[model samples]
Target chain A: MDALVIGTIIKVVLVLLIVSALAGFGTYIERKVLAFMQRRLGPTHVGPFGLLQIAADGIKLFTKEDIIPQHANKFIFSLAPVITAATAFIALSAVPLFPTFVIPESLPLIGGAIVPSVIADVNIGILFVLGMMAAGLYGPLLAGMAQANKWGILGSARTAVQFLSYEVVTGLSVLAPIMLVGSLSLIDFNSAQAGGIGSWIIWQQPVAFVLFLIAGFAETNRTPFDLLEHEAEIISGYVTEYSGLRWGMFFIGEYSNMFTVSILAAVIFCGGYGDLGFIPGSLALLLKVVFFFFLMLWVRASWPHIRPDQLMWLCWKVLMPLAVVNIVITGIVVMI
Target chain B: MFEQIAFYLFSFLTIGLFLVTVFSNNILYAMTSLAAGMVLIAGFFFLNGADFLGVVQIIVYVGAVMALYAFGMMFFNVTKVVKEKNTSNLLVLFLGVSIALLMVIMFLSPIVPEAIFASVPPEPNATNPEAVGMVLFSKYLVPFEVSAVMLLIAMIGGIILAGKKMDQSLTKIEDEIISEKDVK
Candidate 1:
């Protein structure tokens, strides 16, 4: 096989294994973080500092029964979680996870292949990532609609509204940075800010950064914009009827998406994979991603989720217009 | 060799998905198949090296347009079989045949002489999106702005049509009904 093909396969496998494991680990982190915030010990009985709680949960989920509701559309119900997980991973293909590394020539059959940080690295990397994430909306939407439960229907309706509304903001907000960089590739975005912290796009386009972050929260179905699956309003929303590995797939997809958004934010605004002073490129990027991930957990612990109507209002009446204005301002600045 | 395999595989999958879209009795099946077909159509654009167009195809068609279609499909009973009342089979056949013929002619037109082909050949060094932008902003500016205006008008019309009872809130209406009952 060709070196390029082998490298890509390796990258894909690595991304799949690492990201899914990280996603499972994320649940454990969230529990611990939330527990500390609420002043309690979380899952201490399971393992040391509850580190092995992820394994325990994984085993429980794997052993749990897979149940399909009697009236549900079985095909779609089964396909939904797969779509969620698949699109999440698909979106990651274009993302430059870390600095590219080459294996030593003496290693093995797959040796000497330089594995690029991104798997696909298409010209329109940012758009491709956004499109895949957008496609991920169908997972929950289809799952809810196919389930034949009223709560599921309500959840899917909210999913449609939330995803569609925020997508506009996401696109428009990101457009300012794209305009400034003059390229849609995230690698280019990283390189554009390679001069140092001062050259970061966030300094010039803070509004876009903030808007993108907000929309990113909504896109990932994080706390403030988690109307799609708000337990208080709609019993687990789209995942109400789901159980076992099927439900685990949705959980994995959500956490994977959270990572994608964090990595994107780091790369786009915070000088992704670019060196900061003495910090190496890879370590810098890792720090940024970790901070963003921690920020999400922090926000989840601190703030309250909004109502469905309020979410729509914020998206259309507030965020969308602000994104458009930011784009206009960015265009004017670029023109000058 | 890889391109040939990919092209053939995508073509087969696209056709199969579209066929499911057309012939499926269940609405959910039809909608899901249609969305999948749209994604496969994007694969065609990618195969042609139009990366920008492919991403836009996925973002606009599969991500937005088909999503909206699915949203509308949710109002219907998805599991229930859809029964079409074919009042005139001959008419259906005639329409389908003509549309297919028209599409064939359309596809063939660019191959023939003086059939209004590419006004601007793609620049060698530029990316797909840059080339598209250059052509769109320079040559096709008027038509693009005109379409945008038309879309804006359509959007306003839709808002007006849908928001006829904009002032009346459901909660307020419920309150009014309760007050009237108390008064009575």
Candidate 2:
């Protein structure tokens, strides 16, 4: 029990450090990807292939002036970014990232510690994750509200409407898979698809997979659905008044959410971390996450932003009904 | 030991947040504190091992409900301090005392019914959600269905109320725009 607690602490620390670094790295990758798509060299000045760009950006963000707007609600304005970053990490607690392993018995200090994949193996893992992510809307909503800028207010309003609407689609789309697996735990979903690529829930619930992907994009505020900060529409949106580390926190939160959504897609729909021929489970999971991340960037490069009204229409009139029908079909099939 | 510490910690925090919600002059602060209190109440559900209920509480209350409230509250001037209406201290005290007494009774009532709890022991092997499902679908099914029906009715009512004059309002502005264009 003591070892378990110690292992969890280590895991939590590792997740925070590694994921934050990855989020920073993700920005560099996004820049490079976008630059390549636009037929240009991205960030070649910093280091080889601009590998040091992330470090430079980190230094810049850290050293920059932290400005709180004169008219802003000082307390909630500061509290907002922390909420964003904190909730994003907290949501990751239930996610089973990699497979579990035990330390060697011969190891000195933390020997024989069995580290689980998830930080907290809560029985209702999926719901807890969704709930935490759902709770994450407060970050932007409050940030925009407290900032006292017109753009910020608009951004918060968009955040509320967009996040709240897509949340329904997200839940309903995942319901089909939940029904098929008859378990809310991601590990259970992983094991249920352990038979291999053929047994992936994606094949059975294609509509759900599509709906979930669309909603996931909206939930993470990715391009096309990224009306919250659509540069053309609203000038920096919620982060219009934010500067320095506070702004950086929102960026980190977003990138981490993208990773979370990607990982979730890989785990639930795709054969999560399952071995494929010579490729090991961990490698497969990594490859899948990379592909999903690339897909997001690719879509950003290729697609144009949808209008807010169009977004609302698509979510309500189209995606939601489809998700509901898919759930019904899956339910009937399961019952049969 | 961990559970005991968590319970007391959550209890104090929840109470503090509720107090903030009640007494804060800024509507934003009040709403935010209320939302935080709701989340902490979910912590209590989690501590009780009702993980499903806890998650539902967070998702429904903190995520969806408070979000709507926040959205509406955003339209209000947050800078202005909301003045509380004057009330008799004795009446307020009486109401507070009665409410506290009622809550105490409700809490004690559950513990006093040891026999009722023993009569319907939860399945040892079943997970929390599964056990809840069993009871909800079997024993309390009627109440559950009735409440669901009630909710559906409430939803329809809300939609009707909101949608009633929406188109007319939209066209009213549109007609005003057309008339101004003609005048130009």
Residues forming the 10-long window of minimal summed lDDT in candidate 2 chain B: B164-173
lDDT of 1 by residue, A232-256 (tens): 9899999999999999999999999
For model 1 chain A, where is the 10-residue window of minimal lDDT?
A108-117
Q: What is the DockQ of candidate 2?
A: 0.52
**Candidate 1 regions with alpha-carbon error over 4 angstroms:** A104-113, B70-74, B103-119, B163-174, B177-184
Per-residue lDDT tens digits for candidate 1, residues B1-184, read: 9999999999999989999988988888888888888988999899989999999999888656546655565567776787877899899999999989999998899787787866688999999899999988998999999999999999899889978976554544577787897899
Q: Model 2: runs farther than 4 Å from truth?
A: B87-94, B103-120, B164-184
Q: Give me the chain B TM-score of candidate 1.
A: 0.81
Local error of candidate 1 at B132, Å?
A: 0.5
lDDT of 1 at A56: 92
lDDT of 2 by residue, B1-184 (tens): 8999999999999999999988898876787788888888999999988899999999888655546555555568664577778679999999999999999988888776763554467889998888889988998899999999999999889879877754443333678787897899
Deviation of model 1 at A216, angstroms? 0.7
DockQ of each: 0.56, 0.52
